[model samples]
Target chain A: MAKKDDSPDGLKLDRRNFFKTTGLAGLAESIAAPAEAAAQSTPAAVGPGDVPVRLNVNGRQIDLMIEPRVTLLDALRTRANLTGNKKGCDRGACGACTMIVDGRPVYSCSTLAIEVQGKQIRNVDGLATGDRLHPVQQAFCEKDALMCGFCTPGFIMASVALLEKNPNATPEQIKKGLDGNICRCGTFSRIFEAVSSVKGGQRG
Target chain B: MKAFAYINPANEKEAVAALSPQVEQSMPLGGGQDLLARMKDYVTQPERLVNVKTALESTVTPVGGGLRIGAAMKMADVAEHPEILRMYPAISAAAIEVGTPQIRNQATVGGNLNQRPRCWYYRNEEFVCFKKGGDRCFSPQGENQFHAILGAGPSFIVHPSSLAVPMLAYGATFRLAGPKGERLVPAANYFTLPRQSLRMENVLAPDELLTHVILPAPGNVKSGHYEVRYKASHDWPIAFATVLIAMNGSVVKEAKVVMGAVAPVPWRSAEAEQALVGKSITEATAAAAAEAAMKNARPLSQNGYKVDVAKTAVKRAILRAAGIQTA
Candidate 1:
């Protein structure tokens, strides 16, 4: 065990000590008071507040009052209650927030809901018809391409877009096309197998 | 991200009128690929965001013998444009190396060219580096493996655009619209070094918006782009090069060699161009040009590998442009 130095006990100065001391709290409060006063002195211009933002998602009209800072991913998951798209790196690094907008896949997390008002938005939830699963979904289940199913939705959406563009994609194309999405469960081999199993294979 | 005002203008005039020269007061929203990321990280807090994609032109059209590309055109559309694929293959090749399919489909040309540097010290809000108005740069003393090797000064950030390198090689001219009206600037003069202004990367004013890029008609030139990346799919390249050479018979008449991801801006290597002109492009000429490209490089303590990688990029670009396959 290491012996503690007890000369002046300067180690006792911490968050607990700051709260216990009287003049220190006053010092902190006094320091924060000026910042608050400065903020009030110069108020930032604020408009385009929570307004009626409308988006056409999955062929359905959705109207909600949200702030301009709210992204399309938040609008889908929180306001519209469509949580099919996941918010994985809110920046554009990961593909977990991918969704088809105007027949092209885009990172929903990076897109502003206000900007995509009239564009078509499609998520993983819109793939199935009634109870029948999409062919890609069925293939994923058959090939066991998922473990915990966190990255499955994004992969499925990417696969749908890739096949629609190049149905007869070679192994090289498949490797390049789905490189955006990552699978933590190490199911890439199975996912590739599932994507290549679609019938009517031909490049569009 | 802090709450901000949003505006969608009816047309280009309205859009330009809505924007101000102050980046903090208002900013034009392109694809939001870079701006939204910075906002989420609390790096920039603009009070207003104006949607410019709705107002700007978003198509690529034929003009004269060359092509006129709208600044708002998506990277996917630009990469897949038939004429671009045939006439300017280097542009398409550079576009393909930007990001994955999702990013390409959403990111715009103006945004891609004008995106902020990807330096880790600058991207993270905790480090107040020189790029963010701080006094010192963290990369020179700290982790600097990915920093710039050429044209570096107080800041060591590598330019992050994939398209800018090829555009300079192709001799493209940019059209910008602002409160002072429109002006045409050559692509070579668009980018500036940190010595000029440490805050911004290019000549674009906060109130100005890039409208169009006009490429001169392709002459008797062979162009190619080659990028060397740690990851083949999505990672940014360690070094990349674009070469455009005009040949008379089997001898080179003129050449333009520009390297990216190894400098503060896209580096045009006049030394390499001098080595290539008036010589037949062979294994010897390509290797000589490759060596000459790195003659002026001043690599940092940790980024000497970039010099070797960039030399290989120049050699490969020349070989590929000359239709030679190197295993």
Candidate 2:
């Protein structure tokens, strides 16, 4: 981790000093501008510190005090104790951090928890009702769609959202809809079979 | 991500006011789709992140004959909007191909347009390349399979906006709002070249907020957008092309050909446009235009394959514009 300097702007404006530091001379004079807006710049800052945030997750409003930079995935996993969603490739490439927010799937790792307040956010933790697994989950279990099971929840959530939107999805739609999720277990053939055999899919 | 103060501004004016004059101080957040990722990677360390989702409008309103797409309008909505599909099919087509459905659902139109380059060297914090205030670009001497082949320079990073290619081909303008008020910049002029400024890709100043994308009326034009992605399961395209053909009954009255992921900007191929001006789009003509488009390509050591991929994209776009099947 970088030892971030306490400077508010993250850079020094002294032309000679910046030039000497970065060894960029000609661009220094043009780049260095005074912090003129710093005077009138007091907006309602939420946090470098933790602040109260309420999110409607799975059906209930879960509240927490998190830093402004805390991602939705981190907030849920670390605070709310919803660890069903995995954090594979937190950069939003892998679908392990996928979640459904307001009827559409999104990368939870890329979404800030504070920004998604009041949104109907659903994670894999809330999928089942008591002992009965969600149909997609049941299908995955029956079809043996997972090996390591690390990427299962994200795939299940993405599948649930996909099936909810298009219950009678065709094969092509199933392929396209579940494209965001990946199973490193190399159980894709079985995963596709599982999704395909779910019939009209499960309801929320 | 370095800890930062956050603000959810009430309106665009408030958001503009909240912006710091310096780029490093404050940043506008729409959906947190790109900004948060970069913050996590330590690529950009803004002192404050101003949530612009509520500040910027999300409506897609009819502007005379065309549409004015709000900066905060989600990509999922843009891809499915009836007006956009009917008038500017290329925009919708391009929008649908961005990342995956999840990313499209979360990422905004303006965010897509203003997103940073996906060059590996830029994304990896280990390498302090030119964009990171370092002296030289590492692409020329390093791994550059996905780097720019056309219009390369001190930095060989390709412009990563898929929408900008179709937007420029359709002749759109971006509305920028700032402390100094609002001004419109043409899509062609919105994206800056490597020579223009190595620090940033576009003309957007640190304080200005890209408010809306105003597209002029699309009248009697056939358009096609084709993208070649290495991973259909969600990855950036190898290269893509957008073609807008204004036909005079049978022959091409005018043509606008723009390609993405090929250069530092949504590169408009005047050579291809010139080739198609007075000719009907046929196997021969389209091939000729595609050939002309690649005539000046200066591919790097590893990205020579992209030139051929780009050629296929341009040719297929031409055929698709004419509503013909590609074999």
Candidate 3:
């Protein structure tokens, strides 16, 4: 038997209390407990004293208080109000929440909000200057690259990031690159045309 | 989805210490591609999330006749890596085959290797399959077209990682960090089948963290991957095969045959490998190996076609790697 630590608060810090206070009381009593308890305890909850998170979004530094579980999509859409990055699947399946993190386009929904505190984050909202749209966005609109337009922002942002990396990306590369973003309305042809047009312009 | 505390440690020591005895309600946050989705779907609910991204100590280096890929390295980074593309083209090909572009960008190599299965029963909150400690495996009779055709007994979920199959074929090893310190496990034994353990996929302890993957240098070995899917785009393959052949002037010296989406784990066909050894890769040999590979398959009624599909894929992949044309 393990010895218990006695405190002035009359709390016995034994395995039972340790398990109880940790929210594993039910699990601890289950068959999985003895095995899990032999291993190290899970991480503790976040306290209030954690440092403030400084998010660099679209080349601008913004400070906010976020819990550890807050995702980048939630931070961008809910806290920072950058709604251009839509949350379609929220599970990294649908690329509707795609954004550029430190020059690499990623699914913001699958990235923790606090992870990219110092890294630069570029969303669909960053593509426009006041009223003028980015070239990729312009081409997308001109070619009617969207039907329902829900997956357009993510596709456009992904295209911009892809074009930035491979200025002369082949159609096959474009196809592979855009494989992450899914448009439910089946506007793949127009989207491919828009991307190809952008590539052609860059070459000329 | 649930409220949780998060901590990002700067070093491995700090990470280990931070993971020390606490409230006992924690889970490590990796790429968050799978973990976050599980959380949102209520598959798992953890009160604390420890972020170990900053504590990555491994580096992608060409060390001692092998390339060490840091576990923290993103799938996109691995897919685009020059050395990786030049040496282990199959690995790069596998990395590119996983999920979609957004997933590849955010999903880490470690997370991909350690990700949970995408079985419909496991994904659905309603069905509590044998994997979830239920009495029966839902995949045995109900909607098992996507289930395994090899090394499956109690559970029939297919191994989800597209990279693991090729890694095993290339003789890769995983560098792991745990409470006892660092250790390495061969890719062949890294993934566990349902017969071995129904509850877990890999032999990772609760505290163990995969640090990197070490791939032996491609020395006179030719490797390739072939995946057959309904859609040509961002969909998991219905069946896939990865072949690594060691050749001496077109004569087979040795061969490693592995198949994905056809097994509870990455299925290694020793018989198929045996059939390839000591013989040149001919159309007849490839076909024979494919047949031998699926000889022990006890596929479900709905998934019976997978046996043929997987065999064809294995044959095609072997021929492609051996530079042989099959009419």
Full-model lDDT for every candidate: 0.83, 0.86, 0.78
Candidate numbers sorted by lDDT from highest down? 2, 1, 3
RMSD after Cα superposition, model 3: 9.9
Q: Model 1: which docking level applies?
A: acceptable
Residue pairs with clashing backbones, model 2: none
Name the runs in model 3 displaced over 4 angstroms.
A1-51, A200-204, B20-25, B325-327
Off by over 4 Å in 2: A4-43, A202-204
lDDT of candidate 1 over B1-327, digit per residue (tens):
766887777567877887888855789888888899887777777879877787799998888888999989999888888998888889999998788898888889999999999999988888887777788888988899999998888788999999999998989999999998999999899998888878778899989999888988888789878999999877789999999999988899999999999998998999999999999989889999999999988888899999999999999999988988864
Write down the lDDT that model 3 would get.
Answer: 0.78
For residues A104-162, could you state the per-residue lDDT of candidate 2 as single tens digits?
A: 88999899888888789999999999998999999999889999999899998888888
Candidate maximizing DockQ: 2
Residue by residue across B33-98, what tens digits does model 3's lDDT show?
888888777666666666777677435799888799887788878888998888998888888777
Tens digits of per-residue lDDT for model 2 on B1-327? 888998887789999998988976899998667777787778889999888988898989988788899999999899989999999999999888788878888899889999999999999888898888888899998899999999989999999888999999989999999999999999999899989898899999999999999999988889988999878757889999999999997999999999999999999999999999989889899999999999999998899999999999999999999999974
- Best to worst by DockQ, what's the order? 2, 3, 1
As a whole number from 0 to 100, the lDDT of residue B90 in candidate 2 is 93
Model 2, TM vs. native: 0.91
TM-score of 3: 0.87
